[model samples]
Target: MRKASIRLKTALLASLTCVTVHAWGMSFERQERCIEGLTPKCQVMILATGQIDKDSPKQFKSFAQTFPRGTWVAVSSPGGNLVGGMQLGLAIRELGFNTTIGNSDYSPPDCLSACAYAFAGGVSRKLTPGSRYGLHQFRGSDQAINAEDTQKISATLAKYLDAMGVDRRLLDYAQMTTSDKVTVLTLAQAQLLKVDTAGQTSYARWKVEVTPDSKLLAINSSLFTVGSQIPITLGILPVPGQNNKVACLIYYKSNDASAFSASNPQHFEIGKEIYPLISAGNWQEKTGGYQATFLIPDNLLIALLQAPDDTVITLSGSFSKPPQSNTTTASTNPLTAYFGVGNLKNSLQALLKR
Candidate 1:
């Protein structure tokens, strides 16, 4: 078989090997890899949904900083703030994270709008079988847009797809789509569109660290409870650090603080990956300041619902690196990243009502 598309020259990272995933439509599991026992070139940095602002270059910087030389980033979003997608994509491309697209750790995937735009940035991107990506007729609004605006979005997307070396046929189809035809690419289609670079990249050997004040920190928002499968973003940084490993850590807190559960609480870590197919534990420093994304699961909805409304998610984490904790993703444009938070919440409510 052909080697993966990753082009890193680092000595520590040799393409390990991929353990074939035979789970086909078995459970609709969103996370393609649990990563607990598996290894990768490095940990998959994640981004939160609807957090990045459109046309915001700062988002680009945020990702660039987290894993300056990371293997891949998992983008979880309902879509919004796509303007900065171009800049963010460029940043990912420049940083050598050109091997594969990132995947969510806890929740199932439903990437949309700007999230998909950023997804197109990987050197060699792919999606799980059930992954869903959406494209609307308008660039950023639910209101009616003129034909010219639609054309502009199309051209912009075309340029980006081309930059990622996407097949012309897929780009052609995407470019011509009208509002009447919202485009969504399934995982199977993503494979055909984005050439397979599966076993090519991992964050096994990047020069990362956990400083006392690393700029990028994990956003384990305090708005969710246990069993709540939430989609989040893992911001990567590239600044100097104590060790040549990935920064930050992800931890899940159960109702019983006395008990810690890896399967119950999903953590997405950042560090030099173990390539080919590495387990989540392959990297050192399983706890403490690290680049792991801790999210809330949906199964805990009942417990949360029993509590008062607007129950804030209880999350805690730390940052270690240069004291740039205030160092936001550098961007020239104002941003307003959007996600289906409202939609998701509504859906959850509707399910509750049912």
Candidate 2:
């Protein structure tokens, strides 16, 4: 019985090795498309498919030399070789190419496990509605991997993801999933995790609601922020006692010991105009963080509504140090929030029609 058990283990190991070798064999193909209208133009499209191996990066580098920067690379793979996938992703990024999950025929394709890492290298990563991006726990290629080696590998992966500007929670999700099972990400999940870097319009939308006083409240709670540790909410509503004017309300959260204060100078930069924002009141302590509100002028709110969908509105403020008893010196730190106006006009128009 002992001999039989040893034989079975050896056979299973051999089988796994064979499967890994076959899966690691990746291919690179170049496709061309041209417009034959009044002004003819041609472009090259790269189709990268199959599992990633140690040599995949070198192969891609050689193939990419013939194409120009900003070329589109469509990939379809079941994933293989974690390090190889990361290396391929670096190469793709270095070449300044865009990436999507699909085949040459435009059929729905899967970028799973290591393939997802490779896809992250794109200057602009795009995952269509029908495509799949999946993750799973990392598995040792050989049975001899020790815990120390595993830790090193995990640390390396974390570093790679950080460099790619992806949230580390993605790696946490992958680690929590079993190796035999895959965790597929939805479009919303991808956007929230910073996996979809293409700046899609679906990230934010405007919605309307009626207040208790029978007033129309047009709110866009999905405002995106940068250079800030807390999430911010933005809304537009009628100014109290003013019939023709509307005010923009901005809400943000901060920690109890945070340097943010109502006395800090705040302003909004809408297009080329800068407008001062008045603080609503004192900060209210909340479960996770302290909440504060600011109001934007009606003219600035009109400017925001008239701006293009791609316009980026800026909210700037300063964080001042707490007053000291013995010292008269104080320091101020600058903070800014940037959010795009996406689907705002159409959504507002649709809301008003109701």
Candidate 3:
């Protein structure tokens, strides 16, 4: 029986391995559109976890040619092709295309490794409900990369992420640490990382009730949780509609707390306030409720450890300035009418319970 069980486990793992390497297990409609004969649209629906190698070079080359004007290459990959994936990530910078992670159809979350790379490249990035981005340690079959190589990889990735406009701090999370491999970013973390976070808009995103007069002032988060990552979901009242576009400043709290002094604080932008900084990515229920996860940078974790239990999660919001000439005042989203921080949690708890 033990032998049989081992065989079963190995079989399952092998099956999953195959799925992970190739961009299989997805149901998507390929949309054919080109811009300036360079970038092309590769829209996809992520119904299951898998990799993407199909026409990757074509997609990469196209984006490199047409991306400066915001051409998008849609994708639905659980993530695969690390080297190719990294190359694709680099292409986003070279091609200059705004990336997209959701297909027109309702799809499962894009997750793990390579998919996360592509998701991060969204010019106007997004992490809708079903949308997900995952991370893991760098690994291979025979030989292993040394520490120096990993550092080189980190530096290269830093450049890639910088080009994507991700929080500079997130680069630390993107680095590979353990060979075991397993880093998934929940929706809450996605918000903290300032990945374009939209609830249920693109696929399976958190749904915020907004009214005709609703307006979200800003979004914020605490520092990334140490030891283990904590999921966080920052709120934005007037989320982008069908387009799923969002832009804002994401303050990455350094793991080194000394850099942030209370008397002469430099953490907050404009020195307005301070808070913890959590990683960002799409978070959904593994079984029930939301599950957010991201690598906790050592520095942010250190700061959080010293923080008090009641430490308010400092944050900020940047509402796009209204039309300069509009005479009308504004209203708020009824769904976002909560009074306190706990209120949002309570509401989410209630939502999860339901």
Per-model TM-score, in order, reads: 0.40, 0.48, 0.39
lDDT of each: 0.37, 0.63, 0.39
Whole-model lDDT, candidate 2? 0.63
For candidate 3, the 10 contiguous residues with the lowest summed lDDT are 331-340
**What are the C-alpha RMSDs, in order, of all predicted structures?**
21.3, 13.1, 19.8
**Candidate 2 wrongly placed segments (more than 4 Å):** 1-24, 32-43, 104-108, 200-354
User: Where is the poorest 10-residue window by lDDT in model 2?
Assistant: 1-10
What's the C-alpha lDDT at position 146 in model 1? 59
- For model 2, residues 1-354, the per-residue Cα lDDT tens digits are 011121223322221211122453688888764422101245667889888776888899898887875687888888887767876877776555767776645333888888888887775677766788998877766775457755655666675666555767888878788777888999888878778765432224567778798877676542212322344566666657755555555555444344544466678787678988777776665554455556656677567669886575667666575321111223224555555576666544543442
* lDDT pick, better of 2 and 3: 2
Candidate 1, run of 10 with poorest lDDT:
1-10
lDDT of 3 by residue, 92-148 (tens): 433334455554444454556656665664434555456556666555434556676
Question: By descending TM-score, how would the candidates be arranged?
Answer: 2, 1, 3
Which candidate has the highest lDDT of all? 2
Model 1 global lDDT (CA atoms, 0 to 1):
0.37
